[model samples]
Every structure is written in structure tokens, then in C-alpha cells.
Target: MREIKILAVVVVLTLITYWGVEPFAHSQMHPHVDPANYDFAQADKVSAKEQVDEKKEALEKAEAQAKATGNEKLTHIPKSEYNEAVKFEKTINDFWASNKEALSLTGNATNGATLVQANCTACHSIKKEGFPPVMDDASSAAAYGVVPPDLSTAGKLYSKEYLVGFIKEPTLASKVSHKFVDGRVHPMPSYSWMQPQEIADMVAYLQSIAPDKMTDKEVFQNACQRCHGIKYGDMLGGTMAAHTPETNIKAYMGKVPPDLSQYIRSRGAQYLHEFINDPQKHLESTAMPRVGLTKDSEEKVISYLEKVGDSKKAQREELGPKFLIYLVIFAIFAWLWKASKWRDVH
Candidate 1:
């Protein structure tokens, strides 16, 4: 009876502690917002195709005006005509702001395929099935001192918005230092000249063909494949020479970069974003250069890392309350049994 009373007291105290602290812990861990303050339902209400059509019309009108003025550069166009372009861009931006997910959900893959073949195929390859080199890796290495990374899994690797901004300004995105020598000085040039419609189509095309879902495996392959290796199934993939032959890395970066299979778990998403955006910010004189990934890309990368490191976190969180309830029920049963057994003695 004494032992039963002790167990009951322990159970009650445990329940009290959990109930009292769980809300605070949850609030700290995941802040809640009032849904009434935000119009989440508006996302579904807006038609993606309608928005795209409106954007196309606006671009066409501006292009026609630019052509009449005999101006090859859109920037050289008259202010009155340019304001029309800016107006449409703002409309789309505002629409996307309210419907954040619509941007990725929109775009035409077929048109994007044509645009990609014309502009991107010269450097990037869409084929991801095998480790086949799209361009002459050996020749590129000889010329540039390092081969360019493949874009086969890029759609799965990066978010739509990040890709959009990057395609617009590759130099800004990479954030390379002026001192970086060889071909690094002349990395992929910006395609800011492309029309808004063309950019959207290209982004759509990438997303359409990308893996229906992203995984940590794809994220590592796209971002870290050139410098890191991790075993996948029976084959040992990625660049084995990443660490060894230290002289090769030192020639470019002054140090061999570390493996990042467990980086997200250790460093966290926020840190990873800062590091990717500007490595010099965290560790001055570090060899790692700023990649200039946008906010969307950072989010996608973090999501992939979470899958790799904490796949069961969601399930565990869901079961927590059920487990607590079971413990309470067990305690009650134990208390009842003790009471019945002592009834005659009392």
C-alpha cells in the first residue's frame, strides 16, 4: 500500500511537471501565430495560370514599345515604358507574397525546356541518371583548373526563388572574392538580360523535371558532391580526391574542406545559411567562398538535412501525448488495486 501510494505520488508529480512545462517548452520551440491575422486561404483562391498570363501580356507590351524605340537594351528603354514593366513585376511580387507556395507551383515546363536547351545546355546538363560528364571534365579542369558542377539534380537541390535570383545574377550569387585566380575570376555570367517570362519558364521546367520530392541525398550531391563523399548503397560516390592530394585543394582554396554529411545536424540551418552566404563572416580567412544562396535555397537545404538527421521527429512528437495518457491510466489502475487490497485490513 505504501509503495502504491508512493508510485501514485510520483505519477502525479510527473504529470504536473509535464503539463506545466510542456506548453512553455513548445511555445519557445515553435511560436504560434493567430491564423485569423493571415489570409492563408487566399493562396488557393489565386489562379497561377491567370497570374502567368497577365505577366506575359505586360512583358509583351513593354517589349513592343522597346522595339519601336530601336533600343537593344531593355535598360535603355524610356522611363514611361519601363514603369509599365516595373508595375507588372510588382503585381506578381505582391501576389506571390500572399501566396508564397504559388511561385514554385506555377511555371510552364515545356517552354522552360526550350529556353534551357538554348541558354543553359552550353554549361549545365540535365541528365542525372549516371555520372556521365556533360562536358569534357578533363579539358575543363585543364583550362579552368576545376570542372564545373553538373545541374542535373538542381531542381531538387535548390528552391525556385533562389534559382530565379541566381539565374539573374550568378556573380552576385557566388560572391567570389576578387583575389580568386584562374577561371574562378570568370565564373558563370549573369543572365539578367532574359525576360521575366523566360526566367519563370526555366524555373518551372526545372521543378517539373526535378524529383517529386527532395531528399538529403540530392541536397548533398548538388552542393557538396564536388568536395565531399559519402557511401550510397554499394557504390562509394562523390569526389574521393576531395581531401587527399592536399596540394590540389591548397592550390585553389589553401585547405581541404571538411565533409558535411553531418554538418546540418551540428551547425544548424541558420548557421549554414550564414556560412553559405558568406563564409568569411563566421571564420575569417577561411578557404570556403560565399555561395550566395538565397533564402529559399537555404530553406530547401535545411529541409533536406532534417530528413537525413531527424526523419522520425514528427512521428515522435505526435505520439508524446498518447504516451503520457497511457502512463496516467496505468497509475490509476495501480492505485485502485492497492485500495481494494487494503479494504479488508482497514
Candidate 2:
């Protein structure tokens, strides 16, 4: 109860200090590209044809060599011939596959042959140029006739989740999204059977099978941006790194909160070096949580926070002019807003 109350007060003061200041991580960015589409049709044809051909060629060569072995028998031939025949077939298949094409399905498309059998064969057959439709429209796959979207570059076009989601929960996204909203609709009719995580993992593996140019930015924005802002300053108002008065922190916490900035600056970085390495050792009953941070992340966070002071120093030269401009703007806004209807709300 006591600690919670102290925590609540700290949080409240932090919020009050923040007022209307915006966090740094939120970007008013307009995205320039979409990554939720693929072409499974082309992929299926290439994959199926290549696999079937490899298997067929192996079996044929095996049979042919059996006839030539002069044992005059093919069935239970000597182990050497049988093994050689198998090896020859495998080498041929491997060489062909080395150049033919890699699996084109989405990361979640499937693994080895199992995924190939389930998703690839469902809508496509290996063929060149023309093929039966695999997707009738967007919401559903082709009516078992129209060519499935060419899958050769499906893995490359969209993200892993895009492919996996399309497979397990096609309704989430598809060859086309309009059908789900307001176009010629094609419903697959059922998908209550697949586990979400399995599909996600499958997609991850599929996407990784091919090369990718994805920046960590995409992953960060997609996962962490909502809860924690993107940039360092964005975490606690650009002011978080400021030398928040130890008095102020204590005022908020009912105890003399440690002055992180002073500890960082005066002890020649060593104080912070020890404090961050083990805060509990330096200050017992510290309100700071373990944060579950590892040594590396803790080091990185501390190093960056160390910048909180340096960044201020770097910007100090401009503060005078910037402050003047802000004062002018504040005065003008105050004058204008003083007469505005909103000012008299009380």
C-alpha cells in the first residue's frame, strides 16, 4: 500500500510535468509502401513441377540402371547398385533444384513438402504460361480452376505474417482485400482449425527462406512504437533527460530520489557505471524496478541516458534564441487566446 501510493504520486507528478508535451517516438509519418500481397500461382506451378520432375527422374534412372546391371533382375538387386541408383537420382534432383527454383510460398506457406502439399497443391499445378485458376476472387482461392497467384515471389513481396495469415486465416487478407469489403467475393468457407502461433512460426520460417532487405525500423515500429516511443528523448518528454531537480523527484516520491544526472556527470561516468550496474547496491529500498534488463540493455540504456546531459550541452548554444522565439510566441498566443471563447469557459 505504501509503495503503491508513492508510485502513484510519482506518476501523477510526471504526468503533470508532461502537460501537453508530445513524446518523441510518435511519428506523423505517412507510409509510402504496402507489404501485404503475394503471388502464389506462379510459385505453385514451379514448385510442384520441380518436385514431381525430380522424383520421377530419380525413379526412371533407378529402373534403367537396374536393367543394365546384367544381374537381369531389378527387384531385390545388390545393395551397391541400389545405393548407387538412389545416389544418382538424388544428385540429379539436387542439381536440378539448385537452379530450377526455390519454394515460392509465403514463410508460413509450409515447410519442406508438408506445407507444399497442403497450400501449394490446393490451388495450383506446375505448368508454364497458362494454368487453371486457383483463386476465383480475393476472399477465397480460385474456384479450383483459375490460376493461383504466381507464388514465385510471394515470399519476397509481402511479409511473413502476410503469407501465414493469408493461409490460416485467409479472411484476414487475401490475393485481394476488396473482395472482403466490396468486390467479387470468394469465400473459402472454413478456417477454425489452425493454431495462430503455428501459422505465425511457419510464416517466419518461410519468409526467412529467402533473402530480405527489411530494416529493424519496420520491426520496431510495428511492435514497440505503441508502448514505448521510437527515439531516446521520446521516452519522457524531451525534458526527461534534463537535470530533473533531485528535490523535485523527492517532492514527488516522499524521499530524496537519487540525482542520476549528477551521479553521471561528476563521478566521471564511473558513479553511473556502478549505479546502473547495480542500483540496489548503491541505494537500498530504491523504487526502481529490476526492469528485467540484462547487462547489455542496461548498459545501452545508461549510455544513452548519459547523452541526456550531453544532448542538452550540445543544444545549449541555441537555447537563448529558441527561448526568445518561444517567449514571443507564448506572448502572442496568450494575448490572442486571452480573448478567445475557450478562455472564459470557467
Candidate 3:
């Protein structure tokens, strides 16, 4: 009886911990829809493309009616809608302008180098010659579809704005390649909960490191393919082994790297760029190391990921709130059940 009570207490406490802490942490740390304003049913009622199509059809019908009736009244979308869109655009532009100025004031490659060492080197590698201190390609490939890329020339490939946006919110960052037609979750975690200024500094460091010229495919093949295999079937004309032996990887890092086949679908370009620039800072004690890639190199790498990985990352992320709400309801019911069952125990 005593043991049963103790077990009950433990179970109840564990559930409470998850209910109270994990969800709260998730809400605070992860990007989620605004609870007060977002309506999932309404959001799903029409996609942007569908909405545009409907408007076009309506306009066509209106034009036909006007032609038959000889009415010349101009048809226009609501001015307020246009004004609201313009206002949002202006707000975003202003936000970037201010951030860019701040970045200029504080950003420098020399300082960025130091910052990279403190925050980035653990999961990312800048040079191709030396092995990373921890996990290597073989083990990484087994886990994430590819080993992290080498970032010797990232700045030349991506724009500074892209770098900044990615650093601010990795999962929300734009993809350089194909758009997601099917909804799928991204694997890269968000680091936006951290200090915004630190993210800016990392972006500056990456910009400073980019080489003058390196194509996206070249960057992926040279830096990424050692851990990640492109499924396009022997791009090297069947001359090289697609993957390194597991034993070769075990000799160094004791694990195979993940495949990056759908990395862009799972982690988006900005997220990948920032993650390559600094993984440990975002996820403490993560097995992955930083690759010391510049903005351009990172961009190219992400473009390749977008080519292969899940395309509907944004839509997938959109479902996070729904999951959280479900968890919250489950937690409440669990608490109520626990209370009822243990009412007479104490």
C-alpha cells in the first residue's frame, strides 16, 4: 500500500513537472502562433494561392458584368487591406534598417573570429584539412543524413540580410531552393530566444569569412558530401565511394554522421547557416560541431539542402501551437484524474 502511494506520488509529480515546466519552456523558447489572435480553422480555410485565385475569378466576373452593362466603375481591392500590407512592409523594413546599422557599428571580422571560437567551433569546422574534435562524418551521416559542412567561404554566397534573418529565427528563415509543397517539420532547433545582438555578431563573423567565389553545388560537394550523400546518383560519374566506411568513422568519433538529404526541408537555409556558424551556443553539449562557414558558403549549402530536404517547413512549424494546446488539455485531464484517484490516500 505504501509503495503504491509512493508510486502514485511519483507519477503525479512527474506529470506535473512536464505539465508545468516543459510546456512553459516550450512556449517561452519556441516560436508559436499568437494564442490570442490565431484561429487554426480560419487559417486553414484558404491558402494564399487559393485566395488569390478566388479574387481573380471574382474580378473577371465583375469585368464581364461591367462590359455587358456599359458601367466603367473601377474595381479595386479594399484600400485598407493595401494600407495594412504596406504598413507591415514598412515596419519590417525599418526593423531591418535599425538592426543593420547596429550591426555595422558592432560587427567586424576580427571580433567575429573571437566570437566564433567561443560559440561556434564545437559543431562547425572552418577548414577542410583537420578533423573536428568530436563526431565525424560517418557517425553524423548515420544520424542526421550528413555531417556538418565546412564553412571556409560562406560570406560570398549569402546576403547579409539573409544571414541576419536566419540568425534571428532559423526555422522561420527563407529557403534558397524549392518551396515546400507538403507539410513537414524541420529538425533544426530555434535559437531566437537568445540575445538578438549576439546573433548579429555571429552573422558578421560569417560574412567576414566568405570567399570571393564558390558555387552552391561546389560548396555542398566539397564541404558536405563527405558526410551527406546527394541521391542524384554518382555526381562524380561513379568514380568515388558514396559514403565512408563506419569503421573509418569509429576510429575517430565513435559515431556516424547524419544524412543531410532533406536538411533544407527540415532546417531551412537561415537555420542551417546559423547552426553551421554556431551549434553549441544554441544546443549545449550537442554532438555536432561548428563548421566555421561564411554567410555565402552557408547559403550555398542550404540551397542544396532545400533541393533535397522537406519543403513545407513553414507549414509544419505552424502546427506547433496545436500540439501544445493538445498537451495542455491532456495535462489538465491527467491532473484531474490524479486528484480523484488519490483523494483518500493521504
Candidate 4:
């Protein structure tokens, strides 16, 4: 009976800790956050709807102004703006909806090779194919504010739709449209004049030469090493852009992007996931553009971060079950001993 009482007390305390105290403490410390929505198509729909609504609101305001001031021409400006916004929304929607079919259209890698050499070789390099940038890293950085990435791995690192959109309209594709406004332009000029088939062919040529599989470290290097550095231990040496010099990057970016060495531990995976998906969502007006990594690529990048930042995670997980088992055995022996002692007392 006494043993049962002690066990009951122990269970009660454990239950309280597990169900009440622990959750409360965690709630105060970590606070719940919604999981990131990785569906880009859904996100695009939401953004388009929001943009349409904003234009509608502006049209209403313009109508109100025309009524108050009796200047009918004033309404023309907002009316035109509203119509443009609606058209833009439709275009974006159509692009996203037909993206798969567009990508499925077979491309001519041979023609793609010629097209890329004619158009892209000036600003970009294809190191895998022995095509170097027209200018050295320093000269390119000075001219373009940042050295363009080598197209060797771009085909594997980014999504087909993203590559297409980026080539068509860099500012819009990167989600930095808000910052580059009123005649301000992104460094990469829009290639909207290129035929859709031509763009598809370029993407095909890139994919033809890219490796089938890339390690997590390689993924990070291809996607992020241009703007952010990993300074933990000798990790910086592993980055593809390590030769470009951090000072030039800092100048181009307006500020030196934070070292991502401990970001997984500090920012947590969820925040990083969403932030990478769309930088403007978390930090408004941030210079970091959307990286446009596919779901698989993003997960690989996050996995690499964990490997770097949480090196002991595997060991910790391995030991957890053993420790719990040891405690359970010890508790059983302890209960038996207590019973033996109290058996004589009673």
C-alpha cells in the first residue's frame, strides 16, 4: 500500500511536469509558430489576390477624389493603374498555372548552347563547360555590384519556373519588386523579349551538364554562398565564391550578410525555411532576395545547416533512449528496495 502511494505521487508529479509545467515553460520560451507553407503556387495566388484588392482600393480612393474635387481626369490615372494591376495578376496566374506544361515542352540543348553563349556568357560563366566570365571577379563585381553565379549548377539549384521568371523579369521573379521601383532597376536586366522556347532551351542546356545529385554542402554553396558566408571553422574555404572577397559582397549588399554558421541553432529551422522562401515576408525591405530553391533543395540546405550547427544532434538522439531505459530500471530497483525496508516497519 505504501509503495503504491509513493508510485502514485511520483506519477502525479511526472504528469504535472509533462502536461502542465513543461508546456507552459515552452510556451513562454518558444511560442508556437505556424509551419511554413511551401506551396509556391498557393502563395502566388494569395499575392495576386492581395495585389488586385490593393488596386481596387486605390481605384475607390481615386473615385472619391474625383467626386470631391470635380476633376474627372484625376480618376483616369487610378483607372489605368487598376487595369494594369489586373492584367499583371492574370499574367502571373497564367504563368504559374501553365508552368509545368511549359517546362515539359522538349528543348534543343544544341541551340540552347548557342543561345547561352550569345546572351548569357557576357555576365555569367559556365565553369563546367570551360566558359569563364568575360571579366574577372573583381571587374564584374565592380560593374554589376555582385559577381554573377556560374551557371554550372544553377539548373540543379533552382526551379524551372523560377529560372524562367528570373530570366523574364529579374526584379519580379526575385520578389524584390517592392525595393526596385520608380525607375530603379535590378542588376540583371529583363529578357522579356526572348521567346519562351529560347528560355526553355537555355534551361535544358544547363540541366544537361549539371550533375544528377549534389551534396548538401554543394547545394548551399550554389544557392547561398554568393551572398552569405559560413564562417564556422574552415567552412568558408569550401564555398564556391570564397575567392570573391567578403568586402566586395558587403559593399554590394549595403551590409555584410550574417554568417550562417550558427543560424540553424539561433533562428530555428521554421523561420529559416519561410525566410528563404520569401525574405520580404519576414523582414520587409530586406536586400536579400528570394532564393527560389525548390522544396527538395531547400530541405537539403537546411540539412547541411543542421550538420554544421548541431554536430552533436545524432549522438544526443542515440543516447536519449538508453538514458530513459536506465532510469526506468533504476526506478524499479528503487521501488523494490523501498518496499523491503517498509515491509519490516509495517
User: Which structure among the candidates has the greatest TM-score?
Assistant: 4
| Clash totals, every prediction | 0, 33, 45, 0
Candidate 2, residues 155-180, lDDT tens digits: the string is 44454433543454353233222124
2 or 3, which is superior by lDDT? 3
TM-score of each candidate structure, all chains considered together: 0.47, 0.23, 0.37, 0.73
lDDT of each: 0.57, 0.40, 0.53, 0.79
- Where's the lowest-lDDT run of ten residues in candidate 1? 35-44
- True-structure RMSD, every candidate: 14.7, 27.4, 22.8, 6.4
Q: Which is superior by TM-score, 2 or 4? A: 4
For residue 104, give model 2's deviation from the true position in Å. 22
| Candidate 4 lDDT tens digits, 1-346 | 7667987999999999999999899777755543455556567667667767978999999899999999999889789978877886886677666555546778788998998888988889898999977888778877777778989988888877788778877776777766677986777988878877888898888878888999998898888876777777333434333435567777756687888888999987887998888775667568888888888889989998887788777899999999999999998898889888888887
lDDT of 1: 0.57
Give the Å shift of residue 215 in candidate 3: 6.1
- Model 3 worst lDDT window (10 residues): 35-44
Model 4 spans > 4 angstroms off: 1-39, 50-104, 234-247, 325-346
**For model 1, how does the per-residue alpha-carbon lDDT over 65-119 read when each residue is reduced to its tens digit?**
7789876565343444445445544543453353334344567789988888777
Looking at model 3, how many pairs of residues clash?
45
| Order of quality (lDDT) | 4, 1, 3, 2
The candidate maximizing lDDT is: 4
